[model samples]
Target: MPIPKVQKLFQKTFFGIFSMFGVIGFSTSVLCVYTVDTHLSAEYESNSRDIAKTIADSSVDILLNRDLATLQSLIDQFVEIQGISYIYITDETGTFLAHTFVPGLPEVIRQSDPSNTDTVERNLPGMGDFVEVGSPILAGVGGAVHVGMDTGLVALKIQRAIGQQIYLFSTVFIIGVFAAVWFVNLAAKPLGELLGYAVALAKDGAKAPPSDSLLRRNDEAGQLARLLLHCAGFTDADNKRGVAAPGEAR
Candidate 1:
């Protein structure tokens, strides 16, 4: 069966309005995710660098004096810090002096590349992701303190942030779509009423709604209704004509 005119208008308006909301919600969600992820990653990286630098500063005197016991204790304390993979110190000749791990001390640090004042981010074969920071010890010893921090926590934090954004945006999108559909239907109400008035006039002649109510509206629907009322020309004498055309009824 062919759909009624009012039904067609309602469907078109609801879908058109809802589709616009969907596009807006999707773009907003994507932009929010990108902004949040970038901010979180940068914060994690900065924190990791700061931790590495602090450990280097504390280890300076211990490393220069070759105080193995004190150096070992410091390394163990730093390793207790959350997200620190390991803290190790090397001699001027690149020989491991003390370390947090129980392997005693390796003859050589396989991934050691010490910089004078900065930390470098790198991905090692077995270590996953790591930030390698180095600082020089200046108590008459010519070695550097190296701290390796794990980046798993950074990735984990980013993932959780994105998940939260997904939930938040999904809720907003759903509410927006429903609200858009509702407003569109509300706006179409007068048109639907006008269509009903026209249908009734075609079938029931003088039984249609009074012209005064529609003429009060001042919109296009009101104009159309007024035209229909003019054509019908309801009159007290026309009632005796028993629903015939206006001219014939007169």
Candidate 2:
């Protein structure tokens, strides 16, 4: 079916607005999500660090005393903490002396010999999807405590927040678009009627309609209406003059 130009214009304008809003909203939402994710991650890391330190401090003495039974019980207590995925006590040689998940001994202990101490914070393979934090149990002692906390829960939380924000922003965007269209139509009503009068004059050469509320204003639309009226006068004058050529033997 053939569509009117006004309908087409309105549709194009609406879609343009929708696209612009979508891009802006998506970018903003992504930034907000990332900000929340980073903040939550930092908080989790800080709290987890304190817990790991407490566990290490309380267990280091027992381990040094060679109290195997007490150390085992301490490791059990550490594992009982919520969100803790794994715990391991390792010596300077990177040998896993004890672990919560694997009993006896672990074949491999994940460790990096980075020039920078901060490299320990980097994610590594075989560590599962968790934040692995390690600290020396005692000053100048070759022993270290490694703790891993599952970050899957934190990721899930951020995802939920982003989804909710998308829904909320989409609703607001749609409402804003509708309101804009309504205001445009309301403001254009007078211009539409003025255009109709001009069209009738063009088609039938009828007397021009009286200048109404539209002509009283000094806006672009009012200026256009005045120009149209002036042009109509010129057209009528030309018709009345009816100039004839001398060669026609008048």
Candidate 3:
């Protein structure tokens, strides 16, 4: 069937509104996801820092005593813990004492001077990216321990979950908007026709005949039809009372 002009207009308006709302919702969802991810990453990094500090402090006495076996065991225990990628110890002379990675010291710290106690170095592979945390080992202690944690897998999982949630919500929102638009168009169809009829009657400069179909409705459309019928009745009565037509009377 051919679509009514009113229905077509309603569809166009509905799509325009839907597109605008969809864009806004998508943007807001993306912003929210980014903000949440940033906060989560920061928290994860902070937790990693705390874990690194604990490992450093717990081994301080062991390093001071030059207990190589105890320190190696401690490093082994730490590696066993999940999320920890690599752990290594360096002496005052920058010598590679031991490392969980078994590949010796990272290039970033390998070239640095032993005398410089400025910053600690860290490198973690297979994670989203590398992160560095600084902690100085006292002069008396043999050397500072570097702990590396990989957050790549964790970050990926978080991103995936956020994306899924956005997709689900977008689907629901689209369905809801379309459903509302359909109902609004259905409810407005009759009123729209009545409005067109009124406009036509005004242009024609004549009273409209009352139809049983128009008077049967008990809604706003019905009230409008009744009002129109009353106006037609009054015009006919005036014509019978010797009143001229609208233009003639003026």
lDDT tens digits by residue: candidate 1, 150-244: 77776676667767877886797778778866776665666666776777777767475434454456667666655566577866554443333
Tens digit of per-residue lDDT, candidate 2, span 1-250: 1111234546677788888998988898889789988998877777667766776688777877878677767778877777676667766565556678654333333444211112133343454477767666664274677776778767887888888888898899979988978976865665665666577667775374425565554565566655565555545443234312112211
Error of 2 at 149 (Å): 2.3
Look at candidate 1 and give me any clashing residue pairs. Answer: none
Span of 10 residues, lowest total lDDT, candidate 1: 241-250
Residue-level lDDT tens digits of model 3 in 1-250: 1113466656776788778877977787788678767876666556556655666677788877888788888888877766666666777666766667655555655665544433333443322354444344664255666655665645675778678777887798778887877888766766665666566556673354434454556666666755664554546664454433322311
Weakest lDDT window of 10 consecutive positions for candidate 2:
113-122
Residue 127 in candidate 1 has what lDDT? 51
lDDT of each: 0.64, 0.63, 0.61
Instruction: Single out the weakest 10-residue window by summed lDDT for candidate 3.
Output: 241-250
Count steric clashes of candidate 1. Answer: 0
